[model samples]
Target chain A: DQQVKQNSPSLSVQEGRISILNCDYTNSMFDYFLWYKKYPAEGPTFLISISSIKDKNEDGRFTVFLNKSAKHLSLHIVPSQPGDSAVYFCAASASRSNTGKLIFGQGTTLQVKP
Target chain B: DTAVSQTPKYLVTQMGNDKSIKCEQNLGHDTMYWYKQDSKKFLKIMFSYNNKELIINETVPNRFSPKSPDKAHLNLHINSLELGDSAVYFCASSLTIGTSGAYEQYFGPGTRLTVT
Candidate 1:
C-alpha cells in the first residue's frame, strides 16, 4: 500500500508565480515529513521538511505546511522560477521506528514556463 | 568530489542473468541505503546499512542481496533478474539515523537497469 500519496501527477505554472504541491499520508505514525526535488537522470535532493508538531516551516522562497489533523502536507514556492521545474516527492519517516527509512510518494512533476 | 557515487550508471541484461551494482560514498556518513524507482516513478526503500551492519530490510525479494564491506561502501547483487527488475536504483548516505527532524540523506546519480 502507498502510505504517502501525491495525487497530482504533474503541475504547470508561469514564472514568478506561486506554485503549490500537495501530498497526503495514511500512516498517522509518521512524525516527520520532507520534500525532495529530482531532475531527469539525477537522484532526488532534499528540499524542505516539517515536523508534525509545527504547522509551517520556511526557507528562502520555499515553504512547507503540515496539517496533522488532515494528514496532509504541502510545499509552496513563491515567485517560482524556471529552474524550479522538476519532479517533487514527499517522504515521511516515523522517528519512533528509528530505522531512518523513508516512504516516498509517486512524485509530481512540476513545469515552470518562462 | 561527488558525495555518493554508483558504478555502471546503466546496465542492460537478459532475464535470468546476474549483475552487481557498486556504490561508494565519500561523505564519511555512517549510514547507507538503497532505493528503487520503478516505471511508475514510485521510489521505495529496499535496504539500509549502518556502519557496515544491516539495519533495515524491506519486503524486497530474496533475489536481491545487499552487501556492505565498510561504512562507506554498499553494493547490491541481483540474481535471476526479471522484467519487473527494470528500474532506476539509487544509493544514498546519511550521517546517522536519528529521531531528530534534522536527518537528511544525500543521493547519488541513479543506476538504470534494463532487463530484457
Candidate 2:
C-alpha cells in the first residue's frame, strides 16, 4: 500500500512563476516530512523538511507547508527557475519508530519553461 | 569528495546470476540504508544499518542479503536474480541523534541493475 501519494504526475509552469506541488499521506503516525528533488540518472537530493511541531518550513526559495488535520503537505517554489525542473518526491518518517526508514510518494515531475 | 558512493553504477546480468553491489559513505554518519526504486518509480526501503548493526529489514526477499562491515560501508548481495528485480538501487546515510531521531539522509548516484 502506498502510504504517501502525489496525485499529480506532472506539472508545468513558466519561469519566474510560482510552482506548487502537493502530497497526501494516510499514515498519521508520520511526524516528520521531507521533500527531495531528483534529476535524471541521479539520486534524490534533500531539499527541505518540516517537523510535526511546525506547520511550515522555508529554505531559500523552497517552502513546505503541512496540515496535520488534512493529512496533506505541499511544496512551493517561488519564482521558479528552469533548473528547478525535476522529479519531486515527498517522504515521511515516524519519529516514534526511530528506524530512519522513509515512506516515499510516487513523485511529481515539475517542468519550468523558460 | 562524494558523500555516498556505490560501485558498478550499471549492472547487467542473467536471471540466475549472482551479483553484489558495494556502498560507502564518507560523511561519517552512523546510519546507512538501501532503497530500491521499481519500474513504477516507487522508492521503497529494503534495509537499514546503524553503526554496523542491522536495525531495519523490510519485507524484502530472502534472495537479497545486506552486510555491513563497518559504519561507513554497506553491501548488498543478490542471489538468483529475477526479472522483477530489475530496478535502481540507492544507498543513503544519515545521523541519528539522542531522541531527535534521524536527520536528513544523503544519497548516492544510484546503481541501475538490469536482469536479462
Candidate 3:
C-alpha cells in the first residue's frame, strides 16, 4: 500500500509564477514531512520540512504547508525559476519508527516555461 | 569531497550471479540507509544501520543482505540476482537515529543495477 501519494504526475508553470505541488498521506502516525528535489542521474536533495506541530515552514522562495487533520502537505515556490524545475518527492517519517525511515511519494516532475 | 559516495555507479550482471555495492559516508553521521527506486519510481527502504548495528530491515527478500563494517560504511550484497532486482539503489546518511533535529539525510548519487 502507498502510504504517501502525489496525485499529479507532472506540473507546469511559467517563470516568475508560483508553483504548488501537493501530496497526501494516509498514515496519521507520520509526524514529520519533507520535500526533496532530484535531478536526472542525481540523488535527491532536501528542500524543506515541517513538523506536525507547525502548519507552515518556509525557506527562502520555498514554503511547505502541512495539515495534520487532512493528512496533506504542499510545497510552494514563489516566482518559480527554471532552476527549480525538477522532480519533487514528498516524504514522511514517524518518530516511533526509530530509524527515521522515510516513506517517499512517486514524485512530481515540474516544468517551468520561460 | 563527496559526503556520501558509492562505488561502481552502474552494474550489469546475469541472473543467478552475485553482486555487491559499497557505500561510505564521511559526514560522521550515526545512521545509514539503503533505498531502492524501482521502475515505477517508488523509493522503498531496504535496510538501515545505526552506529555499525543493524536497526531496520524492511520487507526485502532474504537474498539481499546488508553489512555495516563500521559506522561510516554500509554495503549490500545480493545473492542470486533476479531480473526484478534491476533498480537504482541509493545510500543515505543522517545525523541521528530518529527524524528530529538535523536529521536531514545526505544521499549518494545512486548505483543502478541491471540484472539480465
Candidate 4:
C-alpha cells in the first residue's frame, strides 16, 4: 500500500505565479514530512520539510504547511520560476526509532510556463 | 561536490544474470539509503544503512541484498535479475539515523538498471 499519496499527477503554473502542490498520507504515525524536487535524468534534491510539532515551515520562496489531524501537507512556491519545473515528490516517516525509512509518493510533474 | 554518488549510470543485463550497484556518499552523514523508482515513477525504499550497519530492509526480494563496508559506502546486489527488477535505483545520505527519523535525504543521479 502507498502510505504517501500525491493526487495531482501534473501541475502547470505561469512564472511569477504561486504554485501549490498537495499531498496526503494514510499513516497517522508519520511525524515528519518532506518535499523533494527532481529533474529528468537527475536525482531528487531536498526542498523543504516540516515536523509534526509545527504547522508550517518556510525558506525563501518555498513554504510547507502540515496538518497532523488531517494527515495532509501542502507545498507552496510564490512567484514560481522556470527553474522550478520538474517532478516533485512528497515523503514521510513516523519517527527515528522506526528506522529512518522514507516512503515517497508518486511524483507530480510540475511545469512553470514562461 | 557530489554528496551521494553511484557508479554505472546505466546497466543492461539479461534475465538470470547477477549484478551489483555501488554507492558512495561524501557528505559525512551517518546514514545512507537506497530507493528504487519504478516504471510508474514511484520511489520505493529498498534498504537503509547507518554507520556501516544495515538498518532497514524493506519487503524487497531475497535476490536483492545490500552491503555497507563503511559509513560512506552502500552497495546493492541483485541475483537472477528479472524484468520487473529493472528500474532506476538511487543512493541517498542524511545526517540523522533515527535521530531526525526521515528528515533529509540527499540523492545521487541514480543508476538505471534494465533487464533484458
Per-model tally of clashing residue pairs:
0, 0, 0, 0
What clash pairs does model 4 have?
A: none
lDDT tens per residue, model 2, A1-114: 889999999999999999999999999899999999999999999999999899999999999999999999999999899999999999998887878889999999999999
**lDDT, candidate 1, at A107:** 95
How far off is residue A9 in model 1, in Å?
0.6
What TM value does chain A in model 2 reach?
0.99
Q: Compute the lDDT of residue B102 as modeled in candidate 4.
A: 42
Q: Candidate 1 regions off by >4 Å?
A: B99-102
How many pairs in model 1 have backbone atoms within 3 A of each other, for residues 3 or more apart or on separate chains, i.e. clashes? Answer: 0
Give one digit per residue, the lDDT tens place, for model 4 in B11-98. 9999999999999999888788999999999999889988888888889999999999999999999999999999999999888665
DockQ of each: 0.81, 0.76, 0.77, 0.82
The lowest-lDDT stretch of 10 consecutive residues in candidate 4 chain A is: A93-102
All candidates in order of DockQ, best leading: 4, 1, 3, 2
DockQ of candidate 4, scored on C-alphas against the true complex (2 decimals): 0.82
lDDT of 3 by residue, B1-116 (tens): 99999988999999999999999999999799999999999888899999888888999999999999999999999999999999999999998774355458889999999999
Q: Flag regions of model 2 displaced more than 4 Å.
A: B97-101
Report the C-alpha displacement of residue B89, candidate 1, in angstroms: 0.5
Instruction: Report i-RMS for every model.
Output: 1.1, 1.3, 1.3, 1.3
Model 2 scores a C-alpha lDDT of: 0.94
Name the weakest run of 10 consecutive residues (lDDT summed) in model 1 chain B.
B95-104
Proportion of native contacts kept per candidate: 0.82, 0.73, 0.73, 0.92
